[model samples]
Structure formats: structure tokens, C-alpha cells
Target: MVLNYPDGRLYSDDIPKKPAKQVRTTPPSKRTAQTQKKNNFANRGMRFEEAINESNAYYLSRNLAVIHKKPTPIQIVKVDYPRRSAAVIKEAYFKEASTTDYNGVYKGYYVDFEAKETKNKTSFPLKNFHQHQITHMNACRNQGGITFVLLWFSQLQRCFFMDSKTLDRHWQAQATAKKSIPLQVIEAESTEIFLGIAPRIPYLDALDHYIALKEQEHDN
Candidate 1:
């Protein structure tokens, strides 16, 4: 005669016992602790995206620059209608960004740039950038557009405005042993942006300095 339990499983003496999950008592490594500390620090202040949005609003209100963040495109694959007020999205996939994050006209010149943050204290890795972004920046520069990247070192709490040309040169040389741009190189080549009370990130001042340098280069 066969016997069955309440769960509809056959009651047998041969059933094996499941092993318990193992827990580690060792402390996290130095690198892991440092990364966790950086994450905590980031959580304390306003997010990078929020700060940029506020700065953009400030610029627009002052009639300085009309910049806007590009919305990411998404392909909706599945949807469910369970007799609710609205249809819920079940599954979706993100499409690749066509261009830089922020783009608009600033002082008769097209401005295009991408914003990125890194926790690395020594250098910014080239892997953060993509081929399509580089190609878009190249196209903008060819057309006399002001293209740059706002790089934030989260661990250092420092920000820099790097021109696309310099960025492109460094990106092209990533095949060598140096797969990242050193902080010293960025400090020397790029313009440092300071946080302000009103705009949060006063990037327009850096843009002005870059434009002045470009005008001087043209005059010489």
C-alpha cells in the first residue's frame, strides 16, 4: 500500500534531508568596505541627475542656455490587463541612447555633453564610455559644436569638465597598458567645476572659459 502526505508527496523513509545555508563570519575586504563607504557617502547628498536637472533649470530661467536631458527609449514587450484602471507593463527592454545626455543651443553654438560619475580615486576607466557616444561627439565637433563631458569623482567629491577632443584622444589610446585617464591628466587638461549655492554645478562658467580658449586658438 502506498502512503501520501498532506502536501500530496509520497511518504518514504528514503527522503533525503536538505542542507542548511552557510553563513560567513569573516569581515569584508578593504576594497569592499571602501566601496560600501563610497556608496553611503553618495546616498547622503542629492543625486547627480537631480543636481544637473536643477542646474539646467537655473540656466534656462536666466536665459543662459536651453539644455535638456534626453529621455531613454524603451521597447515594451509585455503588458497585463487585469481589469484595472490602467494597463501594467510586465516586461520591457531599453533601447540604446542615440546621442549624448544633454544637448541644446548655447550662445549660437550647439552644446552636447554626457554626465558620468565614478568611484575610482586614481583614474576614470575608458570602459564607462561607448563607441556610439564617441562617434556622436566626433560628429558634433566636426560641425563646430561645443562637446564635453562632466566627470564626477564620487570618492573625491570633485568634478571636471573635459572637452570631447581630449576625451577622444584618450579613448583612442585605450589599447595600450593605460586603460583609464589619470586624475592628474584630467586636472591639467580639463576645467574644474565648483559647486555653487544657486545652480549646484556651475558648468556654464567652465563653458565660458573653454569658449574663450577656443576663440584665442582661432585668433592665433
Candidate 2:
């Protein structure tokens, strides 16, 4: 299953398994895949946040839901005056973000989620999650929000939309016995999302599918 960190970031293969050490030396200002481009939402490249942002855009355009990426909270520590009219941010550090990556309302249901990618073909590492994220997710769920994770298995090129209930159970296990959730377990608990060009991950529809299934079960 696609597991969520307490903070609500989704874990998938496509997200870097380990956080990259900020390349302190700023490289040339050429835009990477993270920036917005002029193409249609579907044409965006393989970057994780970009795909998710585009997916959110697709949902917004279609009137499916109103979701947005959480802004990275950074603290500016220093600046350089290049000219009277221009000042470059010379030094900055990010503040600890308090919420998950994305949240909004869909069909009168509150939605909160995180996105993650992984390189490991076998299993996702537990290190991707932190304690603060867990607390945030618990709050969201308790408030009746539909919370989940979007996992991209980058190497396998597979995606999964996993519910938060399954994730909370396993994440809690770390305190007692298991330190990491096994790959075999993830495969069993998660619904695999088929990746495509349009809407990229197309995960919200999967969310709709999930909600429908739950409703059917309730009817039965």
C-alpha cells in the first residue's frame, strides 16, 4: 500500500527514496522539471511534484475537486544586493511545514494526501516518514477527511493509491515490533493505479473508485 508520512507526503517509487542534500551551490538558473511551463497540463515531464500539481490542475479544470500543493515554508536568512532595484536571496532555510502536501474538498468530502516516489523495486523504506507527519495525518483522519497516499514505483513505473487506514495501522507497528513495512505487505494492501500521459497519475479518479467501493460495501 502507498503509505503516508505523518505530515501527509505520499510515498511512491517515483519520489526520491532519500531526500537529496540541497546542492548548496546554486546551479545555473535553468528551470528544472519543477517549474511551470507553457504546455498543456498533460505535457509536463516526470517530476513528482509537477505531475501532482498538474494532476490537481486537471481535477480543478474538470470541476472534480479543488486541491493544491502545500507551499514549502522557507525562512530567509540573508540576501545580496545586486543593484538598487534587484536583491537576490543569498541564504534561506525552510521552516518545518505543518501539514500534508495537498488538501481540498471533493463531492463534499474533505481530501488530504501526500505523494512519494521510490527507486527500490522490492520495498519502500520507512525512513521516508517522520513523527510530525503521523500526528497531522491522524488529525485529518479523525476529522473525517479522506486521507491517502499516492505511490509511484519509479523503477517499475507503477502507481498505487493506498488508503490511510491501512497506512496508520502499519505506521503504528513501528513502536511495538516491526520497524519497516515489508514490500510484500505493500503489494497486498494497495490498489495499483495505472499510469498514463493524460492527467499523469489520474489518482483522484482512483479515489472516486475507492469511495464508490466503500459505498457499495456499506449498501451490502
Candidate 3:
């Protein structure tokens, strides 16, 4: 199967598998340690995303704010049917670039945000973001929608909720200034979210803080 971006660039997912090699026995203690390390490394990337999904489910079940991850639109170009009852997609392209990851309404305010995780300990690279996404967030904010991003620093085990405006400010200056947002800036400008057991990410608590800040701004 072949997949492509809307711009016709090839989206490569197929990696050639290396030829099987002879297995070697190792000491039991060493083997166990290696297995544990491998498992932890593999699951590290998925922890943040899975936590967000679980949190969303928790919110939905309690009749809280309605939110969901947006589905990407794909245009299938070809399909092969080797069997009467089985069909395989042969080629497809993204219909368009997605705006953001998740969106919904909360307390009469439209909420839109992107969730991203980085392994960096000191900074988050701006390359993780796209211009179209920033534009979309700006447009949402202009129309009185709640717009923010949830950033998870995997190495530090920290999460932050930063409003779109702050993101855009740094984004625009990237050409002349630093290319990444420093931890210091993030800690000062964004709201920190402590992970909880029920709703693992517990992002809504950060959202509540943003709403309060917005209200205060309006009041003043």
C-alpha cells in the first residue's frame, strides 16, 4: 500500500526487514534487564497520548465537556480485491492538512487544541508545529473560542497548557530568534497540569485556569 500527503509527497511507512540472525543465549539476569529496558522505551512514547484519550473518555462518561480527537480525511485512489470478501487499500492521500488534534465545546465556549509530546528536557522544537495549525488556532481565538496546546515533556514527566497567542508570538519570531521554546518560558507563561489517576492527564483543570484568566481579562 502507498500513501501520500495532499502535496503529493510520498508518505513512507514500509521499512525493509533485516534478514533473521541466529539467536544467542544470554545470562538470565542480563536478559531480564534488557527486556525491561526495551519494554519501557517502547511504551514511553505512547503514555501521553493514551492518557489524553483516557481522560477524554472519563470526561464524556461523567457528562462533562464533550471533546474528541479529530479524524484525518483520506482519499483512496486505488483498491485491490484479491478475494470476493476481502479488499485491500492500494493507494491513498490525505484530503487536506488537519487543523488540530481535538476540539469540542465546554461551558458554552468552543475549545480547540493540539496535543504533543517531546522527549527534550530543556526545550520544545517549534518544528513540531505547523503554520496552518497556528492560523487555525488564531482564527478560533478571534471568534471567542478557547484555544491552547497541551505539551508533554516526556523526559521531565511534565505537562503544560499554553494559550495560542503565546505560541504564535514565539512562532512568528522563530526566523530571527531561537527555534525552540525554553522550559523557563513555558513554566512562566503556561499552566502546569499534574497527572491524576482518574483522568490521567487532567487537562480540564488547566482549562479551568485558562477560563478564569480569560474572564479576568474581560473584567478588567
Candidate 4:
């Protein structure tokens, strides 16, 4: 019953406005072994996006909460019908993303977070986040739900759950301060998560930690 927009098209009585992202067109070609190897290592088993989708499914199946990936907003310019039932999409263009990647409900809380992976060893570049995403996270926080980002440091094989509040502070400080938030700073302020088997990112455990920490703070 709850309709949420992933890329920031707010639900309304009128049709949502699409983004301005360009769509890339690639001719059908054979993939080489070298390309396959690179993709395999980068993806590992299932892609990070797929893993998160599966994790969301796991969460949903048990009635924990409803979470879904927003479809890439695209405007179909052309389509061909081979049969009455089969329609081929020939041309489409991508729309802009005005918000973070994933969002949904958990234990009455509306959770919003973006999952980003980087090969860099030392710091997470500030450019990875869009300004609108920061604004979205801030709005979610104001709505009293949990808003944060999950950063996957691929080279180090480590992940961290950082509160959006801190990220906002650093994001706004870019003009005067350093452009990127270093690994050391993230290591100190965020919940460092160990990538695991069953749950992949095991973010719920980190969520538990965040909840507990918040509760303790509220108590004090």
C-alpha cells in the first residue's frame, strides 16, 4: 500500500517527473574472458546489488518489512510488437536519480540508505554522493526514521554503516574542509561490519547496534 520512489519521484496524484540521465546503447557483442574475469572478481559471487536484493527478499519473506529497489526511471521512445503478447523495447532513455538507492520500512521505521562500493584503499571521495541524496537523507532523518549510508571498501574487504548526520556535516564542509572523508575517520565514527555468508552485508546486526546506541543515548 505504501508507494515509495527510489530515485526521488515523490508519489502524487499526478504522474511523476522523470530524470535526465542518458541511456547508453551498446551493440550486441561477445564478451571476452578477460572481461569476464574482471567482472567475476568485482562481482565475486552475486553482485553487491544482487546480494542486497536477496537480503531484502529475505527480510520481506519473514514479514520483517517491505523493501524494494526502484526501477531505473526510463522513458520508452520506441517499441515494436513481434506478436500480440510480445513487445520489444527498442529505445529508452534513463532519468536522473534525485535520491539514494534503497529505502523501505523496518519495525515501524522508514529506513533509507545508499550502498556504494569503492576500490580505493584510503578514503571515500565526497563526489560519490550527490547533493540531492544528502538532502533526501536529511529529510528522512527529520521524518524520524533511520538514515545512513553503507560504504563497502572493496580493497580492504571491509564495510561500514555511517549515520547520515555525520555524512551531512562532512558533505557541507567540503568547500572549507577536505573533499573526502578518510578511512580512519569512518573507522572511528561508524559501525564497522564484517561481510559474511548468510546475510552478505549483515547490516541488520549493524542496525541493531545503531538502535542500541541510540537508545543508550536517549536514556542518558
List model 1 lDDT by residue over 1-220, tens digit each: 1223455432111111111123222354633554445334434323665688789999999999999977755567799987946999888644556688789989998999988777899899887788878899999999999999998898898999999999999998988758899999999999999888789999999999999999999999
Which runs in model 2 stand beyond 4 Å of their true positions?
1-46, 78-90, 217-220
Residue 5 deviation, candidate 3, in Å?
8.2
TM-score of 3: 0.77
Q: Which regions of candidate 4 deviate over 4 angstroms?
A: 1-46
Writing each residue's lDDT as its tens digit, candidate 2 over 1-220 gives 2233575332332232222342332343653333222121212223666778888898899898899977766678798887667888877654566677789999999999877666678777666666666678788989988888887667788778888888788788877857666667877888787866778878877898889988898899
**Candidate 1, clashing residue pairs?**
none
TM-score of each: 0.75, 0.73, 0.77, 0.77
Clashes of each: 0, 21, 0, 3
RMSD (Cα, Å) for all candidates, in order, is: 14.0, 8.8, 8.0, 8.4
RMSD of 1: 14.0
In the range 65-160, model 4's lDDT, one tens digit per residue, is 787766656677899998767899988655556677789988877889987766789998887787878999999899898999988787788889
Write down the lDDT of every candidate, Cα atoms only: 0.78, 0.70, 0.79, 0.74
Give the better candidate number (2 or 3) by TM-score: 3
Better of 1 and 2 by TM-score: 1
Which segments of model 1 are wrong by more than 4 Å?
Answer: 1-46, 78-90
